[model samples]
Target: MRLSSFFMPTLKETPTEAQIVSHRLMLRAGMIRQTSAGIYAWLPLGYRVLRKIEQIVREEQDAAGAQELLMPTIQSAELWRESGRYDDYGKEMLRITDRHDREMLFGPTNEEMITDIFRSFVKSYRQLPLNLYHIQWKFRDEIRPRFGVMRGREFLMKDAYSFDIDAAGARRSYQKMFLAYLRTFARIGLKAIPMRADTGPIGGDLSHEFIILAETGESGVFCHKDWMNLDVLKDAPGMEDDLQPFFDRITSIYAATDEKHDPANSPVPESDLVSARGIEVGHIFNFGTKYSKPMNAVVAGPNGESVPVEMGSYGIGVSRLMGAIIEASHDDNGIIWPDAVAPFNVGLINLKSGDAETDRVCAELYAKLEAAGLEVAYDDRDERPGAKFADMDLIGVPWQLVVGPRGLKNGVVELKRRATGEKEELPVEAALAKLLG
Candidate 1:
């Protein structure tokens, strides 16, 4: 993708309302536009990152045996009524009345709707452990919506529902999601600590929110420092296998959100009471029969007795994560996206755009990088070198390749690592090999 053709509307000034770092950078980068209060229209560049994150979330969930499905944004209020949450959910639920005086709503969460769906088709314990997930937009009527996508009223979410035969089965399913969430966050270059949280409106005593520490975070968190050292990839619990190891992995570290952080019975040493502000990017809950029982989602047990299927819901903020990643990985320059989640893998800069020699060399390099299956954004615009460099840094592509008449004449191009701010001059082929290899 060339900058001249890209739809990014890079700004010269930050929007007044964007107080948080992630929100400010997103606006300055021209990634998103506010369509309404707390609602945004993702521009080309923002949508690219959004889709990339969603794909990673999908891959990790699938690996954990959760199947993907699409769910509608608008759901009939009758579903919420089934669980007696229509009145209990409060104004946070975006209630609506149809033209014919029928009630409708933009779902804040899919627990009720998913339960209705599960009850309609799934019967008997023969298909006991089933997990279904969907990435969809949700609407919540936040009284004071702010902080850009971080606390948007309308946002994307990946919610997965797990159905199992018993409490034991539900715990195993929760552990599977627990492990998957750890891996999912790690792959995006985030160290998300799973902390126990208040169930809130979700109504589950068993819940954990995957949180990343940032000064801009919305919630307070306390945790042992050891969570930073655990690696899900190495400590593979094979999510489908025994969950005891999975349970042990999380138990090895003590973590909790402020609401559930019990100081009286705390396990961590007072010296290790590392408290920080954190953003909740993902949440999972083991709500045994919280939905199934209320909605009558029952299954026949081996003894032929009717039993409510235990349920759990797992979530990854499909949109909020984009902002959260920016909060964690960015610097004064702009967003330093994790290489795994960047809209593009590399930024190819041509110092003298349209200059015969410079153009020839950059075109070849861009072609080579693209042919190697890399997502490279070539800065092929007729802009000043200073502006080109600033824009490149602002977008925070992992690697930056600089081609100029002087450098190309010397048979080398300058390469810069966005994360390290390190620069190297290497032969074109050497740079290509190092970057693409």
Candidate 2:
């Protein structure tokens, strides 16, 4: 993509309303724009990153044996009533009435609706251990929505519902989601620690919140220092395998959100404890028959007895992750995007855009990079070198290739790594090889 044709409206100064680094940077970088309080319109650059994160979450869910299906944003109030939560869900639920005088709502979550779906077609234990998920928009009317997309009232989410025949099967489903969440976050270049957390409105005894530590996090957390060393993806268990041991290894460590932490009851010594602020990126719940039982989502057992299917729900904040990642990864310059989620793999900078030699070199490099299966954003506008560099850094492509008349005359160009701020002067061929490799 060429910057000359791109529609990134970057700002030179920080917006006064942005209280966090992620919020401020996102605005200054022209990734998103606020349409209302706690709601945003994702600009071109922002949408690219959002889709990348969504794909990662989708891939991991598929790997864990979960099937994908999209659900609607608007839900019937009758479904919530079946689960006995329509009245109890409080003001956050965006209740509305259609012209036909039927009550409706923008779903904050899909537990009730999914249960209704299960009860409709799934009749016997033959379809047990089924998992269905979707990536869709959700809305919750937050009383005080702030911090940009981090606390947005409207956001994108990936919610997966798992149905099993018994408590044992439910636990296995939960474990698979647990492992899947770990792998999903890692692939996005985040080290998310799974910590025991409150189920909140989801109403589950077994729950875990995947948190990424950041100074701008919304909540405090305590965990063992050893958590930093564990790689849940290494030698991961297959979907059909018994995941008990793998689950046990992760939950054995001391980890808790501030709401669940008890210093006196902690198994890890205080000397070995590491406390930090963390942003919640994903959550999973093993809610037995919470939704199924209330909604009468029953299936026939092997013994021919009617039983409510045990169920679990897994959620990853698809939109909120953009903010969480920025909080954890950005520097004073701007966002340093991870390679897997970056808007483009490389930024091609022509220091002298109108110069015949510089333009020729950059155009050639851009074509080579794109042919190598790379996403390149070529800065072809007639802008100052400093402005071009600033914009590239602010948008946070992983690598930047700088071409100028002087460098072209010398038969060399500069390659810079965004994350490490490392630079190397190499021949055009050498730079292409390094980037492709």
Candidate 3:
């Protein structure tokens, strides 16, 4: 994509409402725009990042033997009523009434709806262990929405519901999701610690919130300092199999969020305890028959008796991750996007857009990078070199290739790594190879 043709509205100064670095940088970088208190309109660049996050979520879910499906954003309130959670769900639920006075709501979560779907078809124990997932928009209507997408009212979440006929089986399903969450966060360049969390409105006896350490985080957390050294991706397998050992390896650690933290009973010694702020990015829950019993999500058992399906729900904050990634990866210049989720692989800067030699080199390099199956953004505007360089760095596209009169005269171009700000002067061919390869 060419910058001149793109819809990025780069800002000269930070927006006043943006209190956090991620929020401020996102606005200045023209990634998203605020629509309501917590709602945002994701622009082209923002959408690209969101889609990359969705892709990673899909890959991890698929690898964990879960099937993906699309669920509607708006759902009937009748389902929630049947589950006995209509009034139980507080103000966050955005309730509405259509012309006929039938109540509806933008789904905050999908426990009731997913339960209805499961009970409709699978009546036998043969289909007992099914995990269904969807990546969809949700509205929670936060009263004081702040921190941009991090605590947004309307956001994207990857929620997976698992059904099993027995308690032991349900626990195994929870472990499967536990392992998947570790792999998912690791892929996106975050070391999310799974700490026990209050189920709150989700209403599950068992829950874990995957929190990432960030200075602007909402909740306080306490854990063993060793959590910083545990490498999830380093030990994950390439393909799915029995994940018992993987699950065991992570669950062996001691971690807890503020709600669950108890210093007296904690495993970590006082000196090793690391107390800090953290952003909750994912959650896993084992709710037993909370939704199943209320909604009659029952299945025939091996003994020929009908029983409420033991259940679990898992969630990953899909949109909020854009903010989390920035919080975890950014430096003073701007957001340092992870290579896996970067909007573009390379930023091709034409130091002098109207200069024939510079334009020629940039155009050729841009085409070559695109041909190599990379997402490349070319700054082909008749803008000053400083402005072009600043915009490219602010957007954090992994790499930047500067084709200027100086480099052209020397048969070289300047390549800069967005994450490290490390520049290398190399022949155009060498730079292209390093970028594309």
User: Each prediction's TM-score against the native?
Assistant: 0.97, 0.99, 0.97
lDDT string for model 2 (34-86, tens) is 99999999999999999999999999999999999988999999999988899
In candidate 3, how many Å is residue 91 off? 1.2
Model 2 error, position 31 (Å): 0.8
Error of 2 at 430 (Å): 0.3
Model 1 clashing residue pairs (backbone): none
Could you tally the backbone clashes for each prediction? 0, 0, 0
Report the Cα lDDT for candidate 2. Answer: 0.94
The CA lDDT at 313 in model 2 is 98
Please report, in order, the local distance difference test score of every candidate based on alpha carbons: 0.89, 0.94, 0.89
User: What tens digits encode model 1's per-residue C-alpha lDDT throughout 241-343?
Assistant: 8878767877668887787788888887867778888998998988888788778999989999999999999988989999999988888888898999899
lDDT of 1 at 382: 87
Choose 2 or 3, whichever is better by lDDT: 2
lDDT over C-alpha atoms for residue 163 of model 3: 96
Using lDDT as the measure, which candidate wins?
Answer: 2
